[model samples]
Target: MSKKRNLRPEEIAMLQANACMADNWSSVFVPENFDIKYVSHTRFSGEVTLGAFNKEFILPGGLKKHAGLRHVTLHNCRLGDNCLIENVQNYIANYDIGENCIIQHVNVILVDGVSSFGNGTLVSVLNETGGREVPIYDWLPAPLAYVITLYRHRPQLISRISKLIESYSKEISSSRGSIGNNSRITNTGTIRNVRIGSYATIENCTRLENGSVNSREEEPVYVGDSVIAQDFILSAGVILSDAAKIVRCFVGQACHITHNFSAHDSLLFSNCAFENGEACAIFAGPFTVSMHKSSLLIAGMYSFLNAGSGSNQSNHMYKLGPIHQGIVERGSKTTSDSYILWPARVGAFSLVMGRHYHHCDTSDMPFSYLIEKDDETYLVPGVNLRSVGTIRDAQKWPKRDKRKAGLQLDPINYNLLSPYTISKMRKAVEVLKNLQALVGETSEIYYYQNTRIKGSSLRNGLALYGKAINKFLGNSLIKRLEGTAFSSIEEIWAQLQPTESRGKGEWIDLSGMIAPQEVIENLLRSIEAGEITSLEEISAIILDIQKHYYEMEWTWAYDMIESVYGVNLQTITAKELIALTEIWKESVVSLDELLYADAKKEFSLTSKIGFGVDGSATEKMKDFEGVRGDFENNPFVLAVKDHIVKKEALGNELIERLKVIL
Candidate 1:
């Protein structure tokens, strides 16, 4: 859309004197405001547009490279205002380099044909053989990826969804790549068929081909030294550095892949980090961290997971290819040298510390420890309920979110005691009781699932489960009726009734999203019917579920309340409510006291041995105090102690308020 103008004959002659050549001189179009002082040694052809180049740029070490082209060839390209293109070993073809961009020392930057810039690229995730491929896009969230990749049982729904993504990819396909305003690409190897966003810094990258760096002025993208990525969509604020190699991966916002880590066919969502490790065909949800060089995560689904050194899982036996997959639920950790055979599910917040070949199913026993002794797997159920590390992990995850993207791709639930894990604990309690009842009480050991449980461990597990259940139910009741005035028994009962009935079924963790099964069914119905079109709308639905988790959780927990207490909640009296509240207070305080004692072990005398190097014993004590602070003054330890006092006050206050009606 331009008013036609003829170039002055003298000006055209001056341009030819500046070593500027073109295959067809009439095809080159320059704007009316363009100043050609810096146009030197440039060749243009095939409907090109040149912008005003009137600025001097100071390069590295204060060497000035003025705004123009030098020893570069452009074909079917648009050069915007104040851009400096120099030292291109090969030509940049079919591109629109934006204003104020500096493209130097690049081998080639071009687009061969119509491309979607990695959107809707079939990333063969979770299975290396291509049966399960997720169509990756710029707005692909983890929950949607989980449904698309894992919900293969409903083939029609997946097909319908895949067709939608394919249509979107076709709609966005283009033949030219773009470099946005104020971007910098220096000392890079090769960039092909990629869309670099504004203010992005691409330096020393070996190769970045067929990707979309969704960068912006607010949060730019950084592709650092020797990074090679292909068929990827890197969201804003992500760091790809340290020779990390990736293929067919979706690196979500604020994710870090560094230290020569190699990933293929994986979906790494927001805030996931991979350092010196390897991941293949894995679905890594938010906060999935693997820092050890020896760890390998392949064909597994994980969230809030920490893989220890030499932690591994076998997805294939000798009989078949890598077809098997496992689920390590959220907030789970593996100790050093832990291994698990595939097709097993570990419950939430559980710790796996040893190798197991029996394929033990510990999904019913959460917050437990699975250990290996003499080639036998021992299940110490509910041990994590008393461990200080579990509580610390719950406290730390919320503080560690690093995503700066305006729209978060993962809706993370950081609750320590949700229906997802509490229901499992309730099942564990029943399982322990069943073992005790079926076998004689005098039995020294019992076998359940594939792991052995000693008598003492079973008893301790039952007790711990009871305490945890009481703690959770109490928390629900207190939160539901905290500020309400319960004048009589009927008022207290009315408060206990759920505000909504949507949560009265099984709960599930869809990658990072926690919601009821009915909601998931509704979402699938909508997707099948073409109601959910944009990926952002689907993400909105997931966030709505996460925000309403408590209301839905109450419905699920209420059904279990009647069975656990053996009382009808509708006719429960004020005295019963007060009693439940009292038991809750005791359970909460007891757990807090145990956590306080456990935290003291870290600051004991044994921990002081290495603190004071070349010092006396008294000096060692001082050194430990100075370095590690006093135990009572430690942040986590003090928080635990203060928690007991605060809960005691809250429980007594509630009891006092309820006693008046009783």
Candidate 2:
């Protein structure tokens, strides 16, 4: 609370001579060191509190303006020390402007009545007709939102979580807004019921209403150039600029939205990027990106996805409203001009090309390709396991993360081959084998899940899924016994035993965080029982699950190894372990060879067509080499070669160690 004091006689004389007027001079209060010369042509109404103006601010292009209040109208506001307020077209009311802040050319910054500042705003994500409404609030984690949006089966849990968020909204509701210290609001228009944080920059924005910018000194939020946002919460390190329009959204940490991109009723989590496209009623998980003008993502759930130009989806059948939704699982891609009807579920790490009207569900078979030919959907399962683009995407997502400083709300796991996907591969192998058995071996085409699979594709898919499952199980085994030296069968069994027993059943990818399903069920039960009632407690529980991922993962991998390989670890010998290591080495080397061959296709002569236009063949070859370097020396190619060598040496080392026990 600022102390109010009566003005001295000298101060009143100076104020009169400086052309400053107040409705009632007795209603205004100033600090002891306030100077009347710095305040001119300013009108004060209602009860105003003024602070000292002692410093000068250096604007852009080296122009300087001393800290003062000039040509402005302030009502029931508090001005902090060394702040500059100039050229307010209208007035600033009911705001506590902080120290060293700059407010110039702003119109009407106020809180009309009471506002919750975008908390408790129900955003209908994933489904437009509204069973999956997530009441967004500050500090809403992706895992928590996942539960709120998808877990409708547990009504008691959802009710308890909603009540907690509503209670938090009521606790922070206020009638007076605030602009924090060292912030800048220049050339913006109409900010209402918004809370600005320290070190934030709001420039040339058209309008902002009912929101909170959670910026800080470490990482400031930037809202630039004609952006209009309503009922939104922009998290720390976020940048929304270039005429973007957002409504009823929560933009999470380090997200970049610009170049006229518009989003409505969406929830984009940490590290996502959107530009030149439009998103509606979508739940974008970590690292989701869409950067083309013709792309439209509507009524879908996606994560680690890349949308190409002219990619689209239809959520309505023309008979009903936009009520259907789709799920493109993690690490998927859509090629240019591709389309899918809603109520479909695309498998993880897959690619979609062409247009298909039939709704398909391929959740059991991951890493496949869905291509439309002659209006028929063709499913090629497990072929993406050898694509170079998949490998590159997995490698680049962690490097491209832009969240340098902030408390990250999403717990992201950036593994291309985890227990989640590997389990799907195991199921895929079983499905392919079953299809071959049910249909005769001479059958040319087999149909499953509203798609056609060629006979050749089924055999190749079985081979690919087999190799991948072997690789994942072997990787886990080697990691578990990497450093230990076993001299006897009992010693080998002891080393192979799992450290924990919690991850034996199904595992799920909750947006970005991957964990056991049983663990999530236990948390839901606790929430329904009222033992976990606060957002902080829920976040802590999620963090604990992430922290113990490896321990739980090992428990699951041990069971998988026994079930897939038919190896009884309790009675296994050193010779059997050595044979398994050899098989692991073969699988690793085979996959690397396939990736190497796939990379070579990019450097072929057919890819060098337009490199050297109107030139000889020699010149074209030279031009192609200059732009796209030789395949042998490319960075990704070199990494692949190095990976093969390292894996071979590791497998050889482990086999040699096991030979001693024999």
Candidate 3:
């Protein structure tokens, strides 16, 4: 503890005159050489520390306001230097207001009782009824929440993790809250049990209760006019403005919630933007965005997902309550007005373009299209591999990461095709082949899970799925030997040796972080045994596992080759490698061609119809060129063309090298 100081005679007189009554007036200390010129109309009680306030503060638009109290009541609060706190409608209590903070026109600010600022608040995330409630904290990341929300089958593990958080929250619980340095709170209605971080800008917010704003200088969080939040943790770089209502939520880093968007019991991760929509009991992973006004995301798990206008889900049947939940994997999208009845699983990087009554489990067939045809759902598997939209989305997500924190909490894996999704595709191919065998190959349409897969669609889907699998395997092989100079077959075999046995089985996508399932199990076992406790420690383990992903992936992929592709690697010939390379080259070129055609649609004549209004044909053409530019010259289009050329060259170069060895 620091030494206490005695108050001077004039300061004691001022303290006496202001009706300040502490254990001792001399105990109400200030910094040495503290100025008293700005001390006026203030009441202090209990053990209060006062910094000098005799400084002129510049107001907005060149106006100036002197630092002095006027018509405000404070109880057990410390006033920092140069702060302009005036006109409090009610009272400010149990707060340690930091230096240069401006509080004006606030109704009431109080700690009330011991509070952890929304820490350990139970958010019933995946299931609202109870069993999967995640105790939200200021540092809660998406991948950690994913484990807590979904891995409830391991009860001992969940209990140990929950115990760690509970103890952490207990340690930080206090009767006093802090409004951080340089914060400006004006025209706020009520702030109760909230811990505002440094440089936060809370202006005109109607109500803020039971939350922690984890703002910093590098990434200042903003809560603007008429915003209301309760039992929430607004992370660094978050902006909640324009009447957004958040309750029982964990808003992750760099998230933007505006335009009166409402969310309850949802965990929105990094870079998710929610505007004019509603989300309830949803687990929104990294980059899950919904911008339209009429969209509603409820009781689902999603990552890298975009909910189009009027996109909605139903978790209830008339027979039971809203008990069902769904998973829309990373890079998936729903078209305008698309709806899905819950207990459904949409695959990774898929496109859902229509309402589907039947609960289709497309988890095994990623990169597919779910379309409605004549009130029946049509499943075109693996078609999204060629979609320009998928390619564009993949290209943009990395560039769009808005997190500015030096310590990133979420370990994101952005691979479009990894062992996680490739394994699913391998299963899907078998499932489709089984369907074709069960129902005669000449059947006009085959039925599975109450959806129709037409004969031609099935055939094409099989071909596309095969191409994708071959591309992934070949790409993995090339990447594994990218820098190695294998002069002999023995050297090539040596390069393929497994470095670790950890990745030998299934792979799982825990929201955005993909790793081998065995690794996750190992983590869970460790958590159950109380080996990893801190949030930072848990995140470090996850990142460490993700760093060794490729080695584990090869372990899984090596076993998959014999079972799925019907190839034994121990007895493989040079001709098989050449054949696989040729097939991979074809797949890459075909998909690039498909993407090129799809991209061209963006700059088509129809796209230019509205660009040049009230102009002649040549003028309209010039106007279109000025704005949208020519199709072939577009940067993405050019990149696609270049990618095709480069990939072809790479494949040919490898093939020529392989010929010398053969």
Candidate 4:
């Protein structure tokens, strides 16, 4: 909207002739060249500004509509250039609409009194009864929300951050709402105090009140038919369609909540999809998807999670008043009809099958499974390490991300084998070894935190953990040492030296980002000490950390190199390096072999049972091959086989380079 001049006497008579009524005709101002012919049956009151109507909009299917104001009532509104505002059933009041907007057939759209436009809305995530209330703002990122919701021990830190958000909300609070350029609001019911952004598409929505559709030209937000969102911050590229209702939530970039999905007091981050399900007080991190109507995700914190049909949790207990919460760590999956009593913690990339009455905590274990047998939970630790599904998930996450580059709010690190998970694996190995030592290594009934583990499973868990550690450390080592000539052991040691000192401690996953715990703590301390002032500063720091991930990752990996392999870095020899490389190659090959076998099982005869439903066994085999492809030629299978070969060749090349020192 720009400066406007009052209408001339002839123009006023023209408007009067066109049946346009104004409470104060002197208060109505229009831009130069704003034709009176384009304004008809429009009622204006109290300082309304109207732009020139010189453009025509060619809608989808070639339906053309000239930019004009018809049958619309504007109260203290500023209409931008070339906007087509018609058929406002009630009115559009106290708003500054931007250029090229379309407001058609909408009911009441007004900013009543003071409003923050969904900023400072408290989302009681991971607990319905309001213990962890995350204040959502327009720029709320995943890592910041993670700390605010989970780090309750630091009350002062939370208070400082909360105050920052409150100050920000107050700063941006206004008596008038905004509709950015090229935004479209059509066939809507009511839009009260909602801040719509550039290129936003809001059509046939029942209601959108006190929310911020933070859309942009790069990727627009879409609100479809029968959708209702209140006190929410829907980020760029978000889609709320098909009766999707979100209350007091902050939906991050590229999230899709459609098909009658209901979410309340939840924070759904980037790339999350919720269709036909219900989310209550959950901190749904990046890639958390629940597509079944029967699925109820409540009082839980999850990342990279896939909740199966009828998969649910019990947050209420007879003793406590729905106070319990759970965490299904990143990359975890729940089977259909699975149930977990609250206060359980599933490990990263683990699978949960069947109901478990006993609460289990497997945070120290990264890739495992919890299965029920005879009403008791049986733990298969580190089994997902060799799972074909796990590998495919790790491969597909980066590809599945649909958020455009400019609108990426979540600082996502798609590494399944980061220092965060490897550190958990290290602790798991210690816990497993401690259990084995206490219960005799041959014992069948090994108990760990409300679950039973068999001896064979225990042994396999240790071996798998060891292999994964080797693979991660070797990967880090290669990444650090590659493409550089090492003339001596000193040179190799120099290359392996940590560049940054901050990554030498335990690493934690902040919903999507994996960074050193001390680094995050230092950031919190800065907030607590009032060193860090704004939310933008916090987001910038977190994104910078995400960019420098591999640099910091190598620092963490370097610290573990000596302790895990029992090698002295100061006096390291070429032969020892060669040995380490050989061990890495073996681990890599063995893991690939396990993956190969796991993929082969999917192409087995039993897996082909229903492939050729009306044909013989031979036809079944042929049809299975046709549909699922032969195992050796399948994409994942080929990748696995190629991974083994590439790793082996790289290790051999490194060993050959080391042999030159002999």
Candidate achieving the largest TM-score: 4
Q: What is the per-residue lDDT of model 3 for residues 1-662, given as tens digits with 9 covering 90 to 100?
A: 12335688877787557644455564466767665555556665566676666678888899898876666777778767767888888989999988888889999999999999999999988777667899988887677799899988888888888888898889889999998888889989999999999899999999999989988888899999899999999999999999999999999988999999999999999889999999999999999999999999999999999999999999988667878898998889999999998988898998999898889888888998899988888988888887888888888988888887486767788889899888888898889999998998888898877678888888888888888888788787666656655566666667766687998778888888898888888888888887886867887888898788878888877777666667666666556767777888998888788889889888778888886698898888999999888888999999999999998988887777667668
Sort by TM-score, best first: what order? 4, 2, 1, 3
RMSD of each: 2.3, 1.7, 2.5, 1.1
Q: For candidate 2, write residues 6-65 as lDDT tens digits.
A: 678777778867787888888788986677889887888888888888999999999999
Model 4 lDDT on a 0 to 1 scale: 0.92
Q: Give the number of colliding residue pairs in candidate 3.
A: 0
lDDT (0 to 1) per candidate: 0.86, 0.90, 0.85, 0.92
Per-residue CA lDDT of model 4 for 359-405, tens digit only, reads 89998988999999999999999999999999888888999898987
lDDT by residue (1-662, candidate 1, tens digit) is 23323346666777788887888878887777656667777787677777777778897799987888787889999877888888888889999888899988989898989889999888887788788999998878788898998899989889878887787777878999899999999889989999989999999999999989988787788999999999999988788999999999999888899999999999998888899989999999988999989999988899999999989998888668888888898889998889988878888888998898787888899988888888888989998998999998888888888775466767888888888778888889888998999997778889977899989999999888889999998898788778777678888788889887788767788877788888889999898888888655777888888888888888877777777887778998778878888999999998888888889999888877788788998888899999889998999988998899999999988888888887
In candidate 1, where is summed lDDT lowest over 10 consecutive residues? 1-10
Report the Cα lDDT for candidate 1. 0.86
Please list the residue runs of candidate 1 whose C-alpha ends up more than 4 Å from where it truly belongs after superposition.
1-8, 54-66, 486-495, 531-534, 567-569
What's the CA error at residue 407 for candidate 3, in Å? Answer: 1.8
Backbone clash count, each prediction separately? 0, 0, 0, 0
